[model samples]
Target: MTAGFEAIEYSSRDGIAVVRLNRPAQRNALDLTMRGEIGRAVEAIRDDASIRVLLLIGSGGSFCAGGDLKALTERERGALANRDRIRRLHLWFSELLNLEKPVVAAVDGPAFGAGLNLALAADFVLASPRARFCAVFARIGLVPDLGGFFLLPRIVGLQKARELIFTARVVGAEEAQRLGIVTEIHSEETLEPAAMAWCRRLLEAPTGTIGMAKNILNQSFNLDQRALAELEAYAQAVAMETADHRTRVGDFLAKKPLRYDWEALGRAEDGQ
Candidate 1:
């Protein structure tokens, strides 16, 4: 299914939902229309169980340059209105954070300001070697919005996060990988195929179990040990009740070939 959106393109094939940021001429800048389209597209993805994975990418060479500066400057709004606008963005950003299925960001070229935060929301970020990232909000005299404040510190350490934000430092894909920002770096030509292959590999596993675990892990830093233990118990109970769990267990007991043997799969893929 392909949804012809104005600022964004949404399509699904082979259980993968690809959300492409359009408007390459503007470097896929996030304008009001783009924001609204993204929210609607994500809502559609949330309601569709057939879409097992979400891949966010940019249409042109640049991923996203940032907000539409001209639009932002021309728009006149009071403090309350601006506050409301930010809150609306938070709602959709939170939706991405709480999404059950895996979200992969295939970032090529530059992902600056809010764009970087958008990529940070993904479960995995596969960046091209030419990918450039920056918290460019500082240069524009704006603090990081779009949940960048919340997401950055957790991925990179507090000190590193501060340096990136304070300095508005730009890092290439290799350095981003060193800082745990980019999960993997591929050549620009190979990035799309690599990301799709990774998604297919993920499709081999029990998605329900993985989604639940991701939910729990996302809250790990915020929850105390006791609270975490309680959540662990609840999550495990819910997982154990699933037929996928039971079937996998039965297969193990019967010495049958397992479907989600990640290590075995890795070895096979490596021709080991």
Candidate 2:
């Protein structure tokens, strides 16, 4: 259990941490208080070593409706003040992004604007058929923020991303899947189970190796071959020394079942 959180529900089970945005009355909008809660929740997860994977979901039906527009308009701030505010947001956003553990987003209703970007930050996005995603910034006379400009183009490519951002199109789950924005689609009823199952699969993986690989791969496109090769060398060297690497190798030589042996998983499925 995580304490002192009002905007989100936090719990852990079987090495999985479930963080659910809890303000359904407001559609779980990203107001100042909710933002602060998120930052605290992220830090708690960061400091806990027992939690292996993070499952990010929303309470009630809606995932998030973006920033609290009402709150924004209510506050009269100067340019520097607004800029500082966004910078403050990035502080926690960067921490969440750089978390070494796997993150799975279980999305069910509307994920618009910053909400959409929030889902994108996850390593895997599990969307329900009813899920609606929109960039929605153009309609509000705002450019994409919250790493949208960077993440969207990479996932769906430049042309399609431009089309979505410029037109402020509302994308359904099916179309989002085709465009590679969504990793998988499940029924609304099964979304949580699916996300949890996916988290279990990730939990079986060697965490250190996966984290290092993810770190390198995230930067692969930006780095030149030489730079990437250097990173790969360093990461592989570190990976080679992990207990998981040694165990898997030893298991193979001894004909013992490896943790992630596909044949083993297949046999288990068949038995089930």
Candidate 3:
């Protein structure tokens, strides 16, 4: 299925929803219209039970070039107005960040500023060899937005995050992988396929179990051990009651193949 939007393309098939930034001419830059469309797309994904994974990518060989500077400079807005605009972004961004379903970002070219943060929001970032990432806010005399303040520091250490933000230096795909930014790098030709493969593997798991675990894990940094233990106990109790969990246990006792096995999936992908 597909939903038509001006600045973005939303499509879903076989449990995977693909949200592609469509403003290729501007290097898929984030404009007001694009932002609105993205929010709408995210809402669709959230409301649809059939959609198990989200694959965020960009058209025209570029992931995203961050905000459309031309659009931002076209008007002079008050500090209050700018603040409101950013707050609006958090409305949808927060949902995407805490989304129960897995999100995979397939980045090919530049993912700068807010673009970089968008990829960071994903559960896994699969980049192409030519992909580039940057905390470009400093270069423009601005601070990072789109959850960069929360996400970047968690992915890279606080010291590394500060250095990257201060320098605003572009990070190549290899360096990004080393810094724990990119989950894996594939060749340009295989980036999308690899991302889809990842989605397929995730689809094999029990969605409710994964979603519950993800909900708890997102708060692991903020919650104390006691709080986390309580959450874990609750989640595990819910998971144990699920029919999927019972079926898996039955399969194990019957000496049947498990429903979800990551290594088995890898071997199947390798044609083993």
Candidate 4:
């Protein structure tokens, strides 16, 4: 299935929904129209239970260059108007951040400013060898947006995040992996396939269980131990009562192969 839009392409198949930024001419730069289309795509994913994972990618080789500076400059708005515009962005961005299903970003080239933040929003970032990331807001005398304030410091340490933001330096794929930002680096030819493989692995897991765990984990930094314990207890209790858990237990008792085994999958993929 596909959802038609001008600035983005939304499609789903075999439980994976893809949101591809389509403005290749502008390096998939974010504009008001693209942002709105992304929001709509996200909404579609949220409303569809058949969609188990989201694959975020870009067209024309580049992931995204950042916001469209030309568009921003074409119209001058008051401080209040600017603030409102950003606030509107949060309406969709917040949902994307808290989305229950797994999100994988396959970045092939530059992901700058808001582009970088968009990739950070994903649970796993799969990058090509030539991929580059930059917190480029400082270059334009602006601050990071699109959940950068929340996601960047969490991925990299606060000090490193500060340095990246302050310097606006471009980070190559290898450096990004070292910083624990890029989950995996593949050759350009294999980036998309790797991302799809990851999604396939995730699809083997019990979606409800993973979603519950993800929900609780996303709040670990904010909640106290007591609060987290309560949440964990609740989530685990719910998970234990699920049919998927019962089926897995039955399989275990019957000495049958488990449906989801990460290590086994890895070994098979490695031809071990």
Candidate 5:
């Protein structure tokens, strides 16, 4: 419903809401306008219950180049407004973190600084082989934003996260996989199909149930034992109310195999 962005485009197919960072010429840098557009799209998703999943990608050759340095320089003169601006940027990812449905990121060229943190905001990341990530905040004399500190350490271990953040080295797709930064990696040309496949996989499940699961998992990294148990109980209690889950549970109790076809995820299968 928010239509201000020729910068960020939002579209819905089935239950998946695809949010594209469209400023390729600047590598989708997080300027104030771009950041505000992202926030609006997130708010729109929160307002609409029909959307169940989100796929994030960039339009140009690279995913993003992080905060706009030119803007940063201007902000250094008055810094307070800049700090608030940075906080506002996280407001978008905060929505992502709190979304009730799955959020997937498809990485192709590069995800850097705040860009890297943006990818971390998602529940899943499917990367192209050419995809690369870097913790470039150090290079710019800044710290990671958008919950990087909380999410990165949990995903790749504390030591590895420190190493990457300190060194600011480029982590290629395979190496990123080794460190568990990406769920899977395919060819650059195949990223779109792979991402769509992932979105459709979620579509096959019960929408409300899937949304609850995503909500639980989004906070899974930081939950205490009692908290996690309570979250599980809460999800199970709510899931019992869904029609699909009711039928699925009955079938499951009857010892029937759950039927699923996940191969429709390939580019060739999708008519690539």
Candidate 6:
């Protein structure tokens, strides 16, 4: 476990890593230290091949409430500190966006501002039935940062994104799902478990294939239809070349159900 997380808590289970923002008092409002640690952890995921999935969660009822406003107001720093804070936020997010493995967010409560965007960064999100998301930046006379502008519009369309950011409106989990923000909603008690379950299923999938798909999906943002079609063909060709895919295809061609050995995974990726 990392230290001083009075702001966050982290633990590992099976092959899944859980990162919990633990500061209920201030809603896990991020500061410099928390951001640095989280950025480190996120980037570290790539090197830990034993782990195939990651769960980003929170303690108390708040995932995170953006940067701790109270902490900011109390700080006595030159403009440099403010710039550094914003830069740190971007660094953490870049770490998130660059992660190679599947990431699942199990959101149990409110995720606002940077918090909501963090949830959005995951490959998919599962929220508690009562969970709420908001773009509260405008509400407090702040502009959205931390990739919100780049990600939100693509998830919900330009018009809906504008309303969300401009009005600072809150959306429930169901509406979030409708807007393609969340993939499912679980009972509060099962939110984290369900997210992990989903992550485990993802781990069983072909690792190289998922990584390639993610790369292609990220590039879909800038590609034309023809280019997208070409990429799809290329992706399918590459996915068919993986060891997992070859094994499964052999089973399929032989009309047998493919089986995997759990013990084999630890030996698969660079012998982690």
Residue-pair clashes per candidate: 0, 0, 0, 0, 0, 0
Each model's lDDT comes to 0.89, 0.88, 0.93, 0.93, 0.81, 0.80
TM-score of each: 0.95, 0.95, 0.97, 0.97, 0.88, 0.86
- lDDT tens per residue, model 5, 1-272: 33667778888766778889988888888777778788888887777878777898998767877877786677344678767866776667788777777788999898998888888888788898888899998887777787889888988999999999988889999998888889999887888878887887776657677677777776787788899899899889878877877788788899876533455434435675
Tens-digit per-residue lDDT, 57-163, candidate 3: 99999999999999999999999999999999999999899888999999999999999999999999999989999999999899999999999999999999999
Reference-based lDDT, residue 242, model 5: 74
Compared with the true structure, the alpha-carbon lDDT of candidate 5 equals 0.81
| Clashing residue pairs, backbone N/CA/C < 3 A, model 4 | none
Which residue segments of model 4 deviate by more than 4 Å? 267-272
Question: What would you estimate as the lDDT of candidate 2?
Answer: 0.88
Candidate 2, which segments miss by more than 4 Å at Cα?
261-271
Off by over 4 Å in 3: none
Q: Give the higher-TM-score candidate: 1 or 6.
A: 1
- Mark the regions of model 1 whose C-alpha exceeds 4 Å error after superposition: 263-272
Q: Which residue pairs show collisions in model 1?
A: none
Tens-digit lDDT string for candidate 1 (26-145): 999999999988888889888998888889999888888888898887969998998898899988888888888899999999999999999999999999989999999989788999
2 or 5, which is superior by lDDT?
A: 2
The collision pairs in model 6 are none
Candidate 2: give the clashing pairs: none
Worst 10 residues of 2 by lDDT: 261-270
Q: What is the Cα-based lDDT of residue 152 in candidate 4? A: 95
TM-score of 4: 0.97
How large an RMSD does model 4 have?
Answer: 1.3
Better of 2 and 5 by TM-score: 2
State each model's C-alpha RMSD to the native. 1.6, 1.7, 1.0, 1.3, 2.9, 5.6
